[model samples]
Target: MNIVACVKQVPDTEAQIKVKPDGSGIEEGGIKWVMNPYDEFGVEEALRLKEKNGGEVTIVCVGPARAMETIRTALAMGADKGIHISDPAFDGADAYTTASALAAAIKGIPHDIVFCGQRAIDDDSAQVGAVLAELLEIPQVTVVTKLEFAGNSVKVIRPIEGAQLLIECPFPCVVTAQKGLNEPRYASLPGIMKAKKKPVDVKDAGALGVSTDRKARVVRFVPPPARAAGKIICADDTPEGKAAELAKLLREEAKVI
Candidate 1:
């Protein structure tokens, strides 16, 4: 089995974000980057599948050169190698453009299964994996919480509004991992040492023969408005008086009742 895991580099979830002075995008200075939290689940699932089925796990990422750090993190977590798609043309590329580039890269590699996070935290578009599956002409299951391999088929369980959905698909398919899929393993000392020697193939949009045209563009970015101050109410000593005061406030002042 040859498993491919799609990962992304995103700003650390806890990092403070501020809009650029020109309202074009977020300020990158002082912003720490890390592997997308959701993608970690996909990487962990791919590693588990490789361990069970005797295959190599390949990490794939699309970002600037700095994203190599994210790829190395995956390698340190047990992926066999990595593929990085980085090019100036890919800058400001929308989800479709990104998926097209990734699809081209995957086409050049041998893969029986592809794993991706449900969505990237930066954009939260959640469109790349499905689009890649469509471009590759393969079936896909999204938001998979549990997965099992049976011969050439895979069974997966995913959550819905108030229940779970069980799905099955054959080999050469895509799977987007959900939060409960598995716990990602931390990079050990030995793994980190070995990862330093792992091979990472870097490719660009032109090399992959994919177009970098973006179908959409961000017009401008605006920060959310400041929050309003809270109001406090003090009432009389009697329980009935306090109840009346609360009701009056809710109905007239707060207007919530």
Candidate 2:
């Protein structure tokens, strides 16, 4: 079996991003990049499945040339190889544009299954996998917490309101992974060394006959409004009194009851 995982380069969650002078985008300077958290789970799941069943795991990503760092990280994590689709025009594209471009990119290869994260940390739109599935005309399951492969078919487990649902789809399906699916591993010394020798092929979306002139432009990015500060309201001094006061206050002020 041949499996492909989609990865992305996203801003480090610890880093503080600065806006551009005119409020168009984030300031590129001093911005550190890392693999998207969701994508990491997808990669880990792919590697785990391949390790268990013995298949080739390939990583695919679309970003600037700097994205190779993320690809290399996945390589160290045990993907067999990688494909990088770097195009200047794709930089500001939205989920629609991204999925379309990736669909065109995959047109050049034959894949048995495709895996992606539930969403990118930066954007968190959480729609690319489904859009790609529509473009490819294949079945897709999102927010999957557990997965298993059988003869020419795959089963996925997704969580709903206080319940889990099991669904089955044919082979050559697309899956978007959710967190808690597995514990991700760090690359070892030997794996890092081997990553440097792994094959990574790069392609430009525009050069690959993929159109960049498309819909979805970034108008601007603004930070969310600050959260309100905490307040401590003292209740009765005794434990029982405090519990009663807390329940009363919650029902009245917080409106939970």
Candidate 3:
């Protein structure tokens, strides 16, 4: 089995993010970057599959030069190598353009299965995996929580609104991993040392023969509005007094009851 895991570098979830003054994007100077959290599940799933099936696992990413750190992190987690799609032209590209480039790069490599995160935290668009599958002309199962291999096919379970959907797809397919897929493993000291020497192939849009024209553009970014403070009801010590005050507040202020 030859498994390819698509990973991305994104702002750390807990980091305090600030929008740039120009309203173009976030302030990146002081922000901490890490591998996209959801992509960790995809990498871990790929590693596990390789361990069980006796094959190689490759990590692929598309980003600026800083993204090499993200790729090395996956290498430390046991991916055999990495492919980085890096170019200034790809800087402001949208999800479709990114998927097109990634699909083109993957075409140059041998792969039986492709894995990706359900979504990128930064954009939260959740469109790349499905779009990549379309570009590759392969079957795709998104938000997969469980996966099992059988002969030449793979069975997967994905979450719906209130239940899980079971799906079976053949090899040369794409799978976008969800939160419950598996717990990602940390890199050991030896693994980290070995990762420093692993091969990471860097390519650009032209190298992949993909256009960088963005179909979608971000006009501006607005931060969410601040939350309002909650109201507290203080009545006399009696339970009835408190109950009556709460009732009045709910009826007049909250208006939910």
User: Which candidate number maximizes lDDT?
Assistant: 3
TM-score leader: 3
Per-residue lDDT for 49-97 in model 1, tens only?
8898899999989999999999999999999999999998887778899
Report how far off residue 256 is in candidate 1 (Å).
Answer: 5.0
Error of 2 at 252 (Å): 6.0
Task: Judge candidate 2 at residue 121 and give its lDDT.
Answer: 84
- In order, candidate lDDTs are 0.92, 0.86, 0.94
| Clashing residue pairs found in predicted model 1 | none
Candidate 2 clashing pairs, residues 3+ apart or interchain:
none
lDDT of 2 by residue, 58-161 (tens): 89898999999999999999998988989888887789888887887776677778889999987778989999888888899889999888778789898989
- Could you give candidate 3's per-residue lDDT for residues 1-257 as a string of tens digits? 99999999999999888888888888888789999999999999999999999899999999999999999999999999999999999887799999999999899899899999999999998999999999999999999999999878899999999998999999999999999999999999999999999999999988889999999999998787988897666799688998999999889888989
lDDT score for residue 29 of model 1: 95
Candidate 1 lDDT (Cα, 0 to 1): 0.92
Please tell me which model should have the higher lDDT, number 2 or number 3.
Answer: 3
TM-score of 1: 0.92
TM-score of every candidate relative to the true structure: 0.92, 0.88, 0.94
RMSD of each: 2.3, 2.5, 1.9
